[model samples]
Target chain A: MRTAAAIAALSALLAVFPFLATAPWVMTIALFTLMYAALASAWNLVGGYAGYPSLGHAAFFGLGAYTEALWFNHHGIGAGLTPFAVLPLVGLAVAAAGLPVAWIAMRTRADVFAIVTITLLFVAQTLAYNLRGITHGAQGVAMPVPDFAPATFERPFYYAMLALLVLALLLSHAVLRSRLGLALLAIRADEDKARGVGVPVGTAKLGAFALSVGITGMAGGVWAYYLSFIYPQFAVDPLVTVAMVLMVFLGGRGTLWGPVLGAFIVAPAQQYLAYQYGASQLYLLGYAALLVLVMLVLPRGVLPTLGDRYRSRQRRARTLRADVGTGVSADTGGDIAADVAGEQP
Target chain B: MSAPLLEVRGLARRFGGVAALDDCSLTVRRSTVTGLIGPNGSGKTTLFNVVTGYLRADAGQILLEGRRVARPDPARLYRRGLCRTFQQPRVFADLSVLENLLIASGRRRAALAGPRVRADDRDRAEALLAEFSLAGLADDPAEELSYGQRKLLEFAALLMSSPSLVLLDEPTAGVNPTMVRTMERHIRARHAAGTAFLVVEHDMNLVMRLCDPVVVMAGGRVIAQGPPGDVQADPLVLDAYLGG
Candidate 1:
């Protein structure tokens, strides 16, 4: 109920924002924020919930963007087709690419798996970079804007992107609530134990990897259409991969809203930093340092930290009630409860 | 009665100069509890690992229901109705209690399908949790459970596989007396329901209580195989535990 209420409030706020009343730039920022939030949320399904940190998510995103770009350039396919219609094919391609990597990498453990995924990003980047004739290589593929009038142009794309983001968020929510999500969590907690209990550990991981890649791909495709241009650099950029990871970790990995919050917070800040500082922007570096600090201090991420605070306060309140009943000093009881609750999850 | 559910003949495993398992042979019948007891470095776990396909045997053939099996991987063994618990409880700590059980069920709908768990699987999972007294903590993170509760959750997770044979490696270790008794009851009840168990336990009390036919090993060799009382009387078994 609380989650639904929060979602409702957020949606209502997003529906109006500064844009519905006036400002165009605010609306543009909102659209970009929402899109990145959706991407980060999709990445979280496998990366956060399953505890499989993926550096190769950008590979999926790039694939989707390129696919949509090529289709638009050749077939004249426009935004008229629902995002859902385009999503299935984009998802399929991403999953297909992800399946083999998942199968191979699932055998490796810990840092080895992380290294393998990082290597995959390098391989994908090289392919995208060298593909030349088909991909337009480093030069990038330019997508002509739909022939619609200027005023109507950006608004339709904004709403379309918003709808896609909402769909991605809802899909991620459903997955987290389902059994596969639980299985992935189990695999994360202890792969051996999960296996003992009959988790086809490899298969479960593969499923998550494929799904994550697919959703990321769809988001990428939407992003490409929104921007009307994409390149190899955009697909394989280390910043794209790092940003996804940072967003999830910063927002509070495993929490539903963590990645979305991360995206909204980080993306706009990055854009602003790029605007203000140009190529010399140290915003991302500073953000990385903050993330490290957060991990060192809180470890469980922001949501869990906030949740811990809320729980401690509730415990203090309860203890105060008990103190009243026993005629003990409220201060002492509250202090004790606060101390104990500080250790509680 | 009926033919043994699992038959291992001449199982041998060597790690360079070390003979982890040496020509070990065992038979486990359906609806019975079998204990595999040995001291540290006695290769009891090695034998279990070999049987469950976690480790390959240098020389041996494993037969399940009279079908000759080669080196079976963990997934294959699971599909063939063999499930195993590790010496260390490997529960997914971040997942909820119910989610752990659902994952353990291992009901694969299709290879490329999006999400495979059916509604009935969930119903069955909940029922399994209730049976193991874990239903109350269904939504709790698995890591938050007590040591005993985690063991019970591990058992619940195993039950989801619906295996004919379960390999429990020290299920009673680190559990309290009360929880041990609960575990004993749970094991006995599951045995009665036609699930074969090969239990590797250090606890003699649990071995004596649950396992009828006890097989004792020393230095990777089957030193004795008989009733628990008879095996307990064996000089080799005694020496293995006491140090010669």
Candidate 2:
């Protein structure tokens, strides 16, 4: 009951936020934050839950952007379909490219898997830079703008980004409740044990990797359309990958709300700080300092850290009651009683 | 007594020059509890690891029922009705105790696909937790449990799979006396239900209490095998232990 109420309240707030945003800056910041949230949530599927730290989501993101931008620029197929209409195919293309790499990389464990992803990122960036005919050889491409009133262009993109973020959030929530989600968590905790328990670890991981990159690809497509321009460096930036991972870690890696919380906090701070300082180095330095501080104070990330403190306090109270020799133990129960008081689904 | 459920034939595993399992062989009969006993570094754990697919045998074949299972791997072995607990409990520490059991259950794949936990599976998980005296702590993160409780969780999780063959690597090692009794009882109950066991243990008293057709190992070889009384009386087995 409480969860439903909370969800409804959150929905109400999100639905009304645009109306409350009187300034253009607020809308721009919201759009950027939502985009980060989508990317981070997508990363959470593999990196956070499956326990594969992929440093190469930028590959999929850049590829997705490139796919749409290239189609809009040269294909002449845009007359019947908007660039947004091609997002799913772009996502599929990215996922297809990601699948083989994820399959090979997942055979390894820990940091080695991360290295494989980093290799993919470099390979992608190199391809975008060198593939002169297709990618325009670092000259970048300008997306043909759709005819819209000048004042209304940003509003549509803002809502589109918001829809993407919501979709990502829902997808993450569903995965968490699925058998694959459970398997991923088991793998994260202990891969050998997970396999011993009958989880098809390799197959499950590849599926997660494909799903993660697919969502990231769609987000990238949306971002490219919003920008109306794409360059190899801007599309495939390593820093974009770094920021996505940083936000995941800062918010809470495995928890559903962690990435969203991180995006809401970190993304706007990053944009605002960069706007105020005008130097990328200052914002990067601030992000680094904040990450170090989070590591020191809340090593488990924000949501989990807070959850731990809350559960510990509850335990203390329960312990006191038990020590007093009460006839009833507050802890005894079935799943329903337990589920009600535990973390929201 | 019955046809062997699992047969390890001429199994040999080596690390560099050291033969961890040197042509070792053993059999686990259907519905029987078989014990693998050896001193430290005596290749007992190595043999277990090889059979359970954690370590690949250098030269050997593992036969389940009557068919050869080549190039053993944990997931494949598990789907073929083989499950195991580790020496130190390897429960999914981040998950709740109930969740640990649920993931190990056959319903994991379906649950993953549907994104829903079956009511019956949840009920079974709860029942297993209660039977193991861990029902109260069912929702607690597995790592928060005491070392002994973790062992119980691992054992409970193995049982949740309804495995035909269970390879318990010291199921009672770190657990208390009550837990040892509970585990022994659970093993016997499961054995009567037609499951087979190949247990590796250092606790002779527990071994004598539970296992039949005892197999003793020394220096990467099976030194003797017989009824518990006969194996206990074997001079070679005594010498292997006492270094006589």
Candidate 3:
């Protein structure tokens, strides 16, 4: 009930923020934040939980964007809200495409898996550059501008992206709480042991990979439709995958809200830095500095650290209770003091 | 007494020029605690790995319940009711102890759908935790456990699967006496309940006390196999232990 209330309040705040902001740039930043939050959460499913750092998500993202772009172009959905309708199907198609890739990539592990996925990004970028007939080469695909008034232009996209974020969050929560979640967590700890214990390691990981990329593709479709124009450069950027990874690492990996918090923190800083120093590309300097800072300070990331501390305190209390039952002495005045202090809510 | 639960026939596995397991044949009868004891470099661990499907055998066949297993994928073998614990206990360190138990599959046969943890699984996990004296740490992550505790946790997890043949690798090697006692009690209890165990331990005392039809390996081959008293008195066994 408490979680439900928190979620309801957060949703309400997100839904109402655009109306009050009014500025075009603010709404743009807001939309991008939501998009990154959703993308990072999706990435967390496989990368964080299964301990598979999939750098190939950028390719899936590009495919989703291009699929939507090509669909809109072919159907001639002229600058209207109709492109939003097929986002789910776009997600499914890209997820299906992800299976064969997962089948191959998941065979190797750790650095090898990363290597395979990195190859995917380059291969995808090369294809996008060379596939002139479908992707229109490097010229880019342009969507007809939406016919909405300037006052209400970003609202639809913002709301759409918010819905995607909510969907991603809910899915992350569900997966974490289920048996698949247990399997993924086990795989993350020790893949060999996970298999030895009958985890169905391959199938569980594949399912997570598919779900992760599927959600990412949906986000890409929405992002493409919102941006109104996408070239290979921006659509399939490897840096995009890095950004999501950074968000997850910054907030906390494998925790539900970590990616969301990381995305919320990162996307705005990125947008603001780009807005300020994008021409010089000096914003990258700040990003690199921030990356170092994150590593130095929160190596395990935020949620896990805080969670460990909280659970440690809980463990202490429970152990104390068990000790009391076993007729063990408190040992010290400080120990009793600390126990009482920790026991308080 | 009954049929052989696990039969590894003339199994040979090599690494480069070294043959870790050379024509090692062994049979673990149903409902028996069969100990595989040898020196540090003996092929006991290698044989365990090969039979449990962690490593492929160079030549030979393994039959579980009369059906020959061609490919020994660990998960597949586990669903076929074979489970193994490592020398260094491999508990899910990040998960709660209860979760560690819950994560191990409880079914002997493969299910069409995912085997989500059932209510009975929870009940059994709790019962096992109390039995193992780990009830106080059920909500704690396994990483917080002591080395002996981790070994106990690993044994509890293997028990969760209701394994037909459990291959235990040095289950009580470094554990304290109390923990070792708890482990032996559980092993005996489980064996009495009709589960078979193939244990690899360095402790001669434990092997003699707990195992019947003990199999001793030396230089990657089974040099001796018989009842505990018979194997203990064998000249080859004496040579393997004291000379080689």
- DockQ leader: 2
- Better TM-score candidate (2, 3): 3
Task: Put down candidate 2 lDDT per residue, B1-244, tens digits, no spaces.
Answer: 5557999889998899898888898888888899889888999889878888898888988998867888788877887899888898898988998999888875534446765466777888898888888999998889889888898888888777778999999988877898788778888888888888899998999899889989999889899998999999999999999998
Cα lDDT of model 3 by residue, A215-323, tens digit: 8998889888888898998899998898888899999998999999999998998898787765576766766887798899988788888887887777777777777
By TM-score, who's the top model here? 3
lDDT of model 1 at position B26? 85
Q: Tens-digit lDDT track for model 1 on A122-217?
A: 888888889887788888887766565555445655666677678777777776666666666766777665665555677678877887887778
Superposed model 2: Cα runs more than 4 Å off: A79-81, A317-345, B1-3, B108-111
How many backbone clashes can be found in candidate 3?
0
Query: lDDT tens string, model 3, B110-222?
Result: 33134356688889899989988899999998999999999999988888878888999999989898888888998998888889999998888998999997999998999
RMSD of 3: 3.1
Model 2: pairs clashing at backbone N, Cα or C within 3 Å? A179-B111, A179-B112, A180-B112
Better of 1 and 2 by lDDT: 2
Candidate 1 chain A: worst-modelled 10 consecutive residues by lDDT: A18-27
Reference-based lDDT, each prediction: 0.79, 0.84, 0.88
**C-alpha TM-score for every candidate:** 0.88, 0.92, 0.93
